[model samples]
Target chain A: MNIIVCVKRIPKTAEADIFIEKDNKDIKKDNLVFALNDWDGYAVREAVLLKEKFEGEVIVLTVGPDESKEVLTRCLAMGADRAIRIEEPIPNDGRLIAETLAKVIQTGPFDLILTGVQAEDDGWGQVGVALAQILGIPHASIVTHIHIEGGKAKVRRELEGGLEELLEIKLPAVLTIQTGINEPKYVSLAAILEAEDKETKEMTLEEIGFSPREPLDATIDQVSFPPTGKRAEILKGTPDEVVGQLTEIIKRKKGS
Target chain B: MSDIFILVEHRQGKIRDITYEIFGLAESLANQQGTSFTAVLLGHDVKSFADDLSRRAPKVLVIEDENLEHFNSVLYQKTLSSLISKYQPSLLLMGHSAFGMDLAPSLSVEKDFPLVTDCIGLTFEEGKLKATRSIYGGKVNASVSLRESKGYIATLRPGIFPPKMHGEIKGRIVMEASPLEGGVDVKKFIEYIEAPITGEDITQAEILVSIGQGIGGPEHIPMFEELAIRLGGTISCSRPVVDRNWLPKERQVGISGKTVKPKIYLAIGISGAFQHVTAMQGSDTIIAINKDPRAPIFSVADYGIVDDFQNVIPILKEKISDMK
Candidate 1:
């Protein structure tokens, strides 16, 4: 019952203002704190819970530059048995990341794979599903509850419009966890100190037997704020006056 | 010939609304490329579904199988990939809903196609497909262009484009079988469980009095609840309120939560992050009140007040009570 969880290092969006860099290609990284993606925290916690129950290992993996080790280390501190960071300044392409993960994961004896439903940066919910396809295994996304029995795992997937679907997938399957799946435990300072002794492995793209695929053909042409149309009429004056005006407008619309 | 293919999505014996929205986008895209609007329907007992879709597209391709009765990405990828290779459509569109997110990623990888998910807009300029996607939630829009790829795939955000009937005439429906040796065998279907709708279901509310981080703390929630009750609407909140446990999960609106299309949306103290904006962008009338004049919610709001909601809610409540 070995579990593998994929994590990503992302800038804390809730903290500072997001500034698009001068290159317009990526964000300004200076003065920002990087941490495990919010959803991935749940994946790491879930994997650790499964490992604790089944008495197996929980391995955390990531594909990024050297700084990504912080995320893997955080996962280790949260009870993952081992941490592996693929030392590459990977592109934003989900396919490339999926390819790298698939190559590295196939070498391990893993019965399950877990990842965040989507990354906070690119917001592309592709890597987990694509990785499962590359590994030729069944996968489910937005999974809320997972129950493992004999060689199969029964999980519940959150669908649109407040509905949930249940599926029974065999072992060696991929599951992308959604938020609120569980309240991730807070990693104490002592746990971080203890994780310093645990193993943290590093791998390169070539070491994973990865031949570089053709660069992804998609490129961001331009990034800009959504245009503000001649729509919202800003009300001026004190709170009382503004509230009166708004109430009048709503009344007129309601009557119409 | 290069065609625009729309993968029709359905649940509980009814075609989802996003399928028609895809048709709306596909029809315009096909007209631009001088190709027919082609819809690919895969489901069980899809004869009536195909018939309904005939009014939307000139060609509806149907694939019916009990295995596909419920969506399995494995089965859909196997079925759609064969169809894609056979048709070689230049463009493909699907909803960014649960099913499309599950299917498109794997299918794109298997087919080696350039893929973009959760697109709000699409256009073709100089033979390149530029897809408008939201990054960092809905705060910014990035125009992504496919670089000379043979085919393109985009999963469009639902409710952004309204579906329209093309004409009075019904188009042709062509039935096809899945090419898989046997139906999806890797995963077994267990059961479909409806996520318990906690507290109240506010998704279908006509008037939504929504609050956000501006509410300060749990003690301030009753004011908004009373305001909503007075207005004969329901009380909702952004994710932060749910995170604080001020409201239940069912009352939250955002990408990870539920999408709501209300008639009159009163946003109080919400900073209007993209995650929150994407869920309620389809509302007919949006009114935002925040202390910060720079809140992004104002840009999309139909009416905005730059002031403290605490100062304004009492006045608003009084005015409404007087009018009633």
Candidate 2:
């Protein structure tokens, strides 16, 4: 069996301060630590797990610039057989990205394809399902569980308000994985160093048949810091002093 | 027709609030464009939903089938694709929930419609569709515009568009046969598992002591719980805490978890991702304690403490107990 996993590199911004770039269309990436996207880590781990159990090859794929190759190497260290990087300067649109991935993925009658439900940076959650349509294959998104059963995949998808639905799809399908599907295993430093030598076959958009014929559907006009809905009043003084003030305020407010 | 259509989303026999939320946006946009908005519902024996939706828009389209009782992307996609071909509307809006997250992108691809997902704002500028989407865990917002297209598909995030009700409005109801020929056989539905109620329901709590990743670890949970006990409150948490097994699913407050509007919601060590904020922003009074002054939670908080929760929570707990 041949399984393909898609991953992307994103900045760790949840805990860090992010500043809008001077262009107002980008963020300053200098100080932020970059790593594989949170959900994609589970996707790669699931791919490796399926490969280990079913005796298949796990091929990791990424679409980005040179630095994004780091996520591919991480996947390789996590037990993927090989890596592929489609050189970047790709458009920011999801359809264009899906089309680009489809042009290369059509090269195979592969058994399964996996991707994160959404990228952390953009969070559009569009590419994988769009890729499945562009490829004309069955697809499932936000899948939380998977069990392979003879030429088909039985999967559970997470729904809103803590509900889950189970379904079965034919082989050669796409599954956009959600976080918590599996624990992303940790690899030692030596393993990562060894995997750095593993092959990461590179290809450009021209070589992969990406066309600029159709104009992009959507384009980012600008970006800015989110509007603070209603700024909070910061309590002043030491922790104990603040607690004393807070208790009074809580009592005042809690009483009506 | 260049009309706007909203896919009426329903579950367990009731129309989801997101359906109405999208309708709220479409109604105004349709008025601005001098065009009508329609609500297209797909369900089984759910004519009541269609009737109920008719009061919200100028038109309501019902496509009923027993097979559509539960959402299967395959059947819904096929049905929606045919309907789009027939109607050729300019826009079809859906909630960016699990349903749209699974259906909208793929259907947009299949129909060759320009698509946007998880939008917080949508407007037409110079006859072009523009959208506002929050990125980077809701720390930033991006304004995006779509190129000219015959039609488009977009998913709006929940709680962004507030649904408004007009006391008296009537709409035309149109019923169509299911466009899907024969049931979808390729993908078979198994079952839906509802979240188990392992303990207390946080939604009913009057006061909530909500914790996020900054709570440190499971070992520190009792300390937070003790604080909750002192204040006569229940313990709730952001998704990460539940994902880490620090709390049960019932105690989680977020988009995927329970939406709670307590009397007092004291958030500790939470960075207020939109997912979590959308759930608890309705609290009567909100307080946040996080060391990071830049945390997004502070924006929505009514009161804030910029000290390490380790510093404030213990003292606050002691003070509340002393008052009692």
Q: What TM-score against the true fold does each predicted structure earn?
A: 0.89, 0.96
What is the TM-score of chain A, computed separately for every candidate? 0.89, 0.94
lDDT of 2 by residue, B1-324 (tens): 478999989888888888878888998888888898988989899878877888878888888898899898999999998999998988999999999999999898888888989999998877788999999988889999899988989999998898867536688889998877677656878898888997888999989999999888899899989988888899999988876778887899998889999999999999998889999999999999998888889999999999888888878877888889
Where does model 2 sit among the CAPRI classes?
medium
Clashing pairs in 2: none
Work out how many backbone clashes candidate 1 has. 1
Q: What is the C-alpha RMSD of each candidate to the true structure, in Å?
A: 3.2, 1.7
User: Every model's DockQ, to 2 decimals?
Assistant: 0.56, 0.77
Predicted structure 1: lDDT: 0.83
Model 2 regions lying over 4 Å from their true place: none
Per-residue lDDT, model 2, residue A111, is: 94
Poorly placed runs, candidate 1 (over 4 Å): A14-16, A31-33, A235-256, B125-127, B197-207, B213-223, B226-233, B239-246, B254-264, B269-285, B290-296, B306-324
